[model samples]
Target: MTEERGDVQELSDFELAVYEAVAEIDKAGGAADIGTLTAQIDRPEEEIWAALSHLVSANHLHSTADGYTLGPHDWAP
Candidate 1:
């Protein structure tokens, strides 16, 4: 399946991983911090951070100083 967002025709596996990581953290009642994500995602720290930025830009995820969260907009079809 594919996820459509602003300028994002499809999400890469890494990007989806970042999204799920954020969802997991959010479900745990904590912000999805980079430090925490670094431990959960099996990718380079830079790649994970980049994914986060991309997802947030695409409105596939949301973030604040506190950290990341799933987007409010419906993400799944």
Candidate 2:
């Protein structure tokens, strides 16, 4: 399954990883902080940050004071 939000036609593997990290955080009733994401996702912190940036820019993720979470967009498969 794929989603289109703003300029995003499809999600790259890295982006999907970042998104899944956030979803896992949500499931645990926690926030998607850099540290937590770093541990949850095998990728380097820089790559995670980059993917987060892309997801945010695409409006698929939003930043809160606590950390990152899904935006208005629905990414459910």
Candidate 3:
């Protein structure tokens, strides 16, 4: 399927936090590892993981051996 783009503008607060956490990892040149995300979002691990799962289902994120990362279409306006 084609990639999604800029689809998170209307995300809920929790999803937005998840996006920001992922963005932080991207900025740091690392994957959105669960440990990194939990630290960045300052939330419980399970909560962050649930958000990440939603992101994955929504096509805003992808998973790899390294960890989760922003999907290709995430930056689209």
Candidate 4:
């Protein structure tokens, strides 16, 4: 799917950071907690959680009993 931001066609700084964090989690083959994600983005827990929630809402992340990982469609390129 494609996202349109009116003038800009890509994610903003915050979104990019969040996406990067997610990608890193994918690269590491592990799950990251709110604390780790916050540290990575230098943001508060609430902020990171919000981003994660957005990802989840967008079907880019999956929240399991264990933790969060890339969703089924997230790996598609």
Task: Please report the candidate that would top TM-score against the real structure.
Answer: 1
To one decimal, what is the Cα RMSD in angstroms of model 4 from the true structure? 4.7
lDDT (tens digit, per residue) of candidate 2 on 7-77: 55478977987887897787677779898888877878889889988898888888889999876655462
* lDDT (0 to 1) per candidate: 0.80, 0.80, 0.77, 0.66
TM-score of each candidate? Answer: 0.78, 0.78, 0.77, 0.68
Candidate 4 lDDT by residue in tens digits, 1-77: 65422221234677557866776786688776776677777777787787777777666667766567766542443
Error of 3 at 15 (Å): 1.1
Q: After superposition, how far is residue 71 of candidate 1 from its true place, in Å?
A: 1.4
Q: Which consecutive 10 residues in model 4 have the weakest lDDT in total?
A: 2-11
Candidate 1 overall lDDT versus native = 0.80
Give the per-residue Cα lDDT of candidate 3 at 53.
80
Model 3 TM-score, 2 decimals: 0.77
Clashing pairs in 2: none
The clash count of every prediction, one per candidate, is: 0, 0, 0, 0
lDDT by residue for model 1 over 8-71, one digit each (tens)? 4578887877887898788777789888899887789999988988898888788888999877
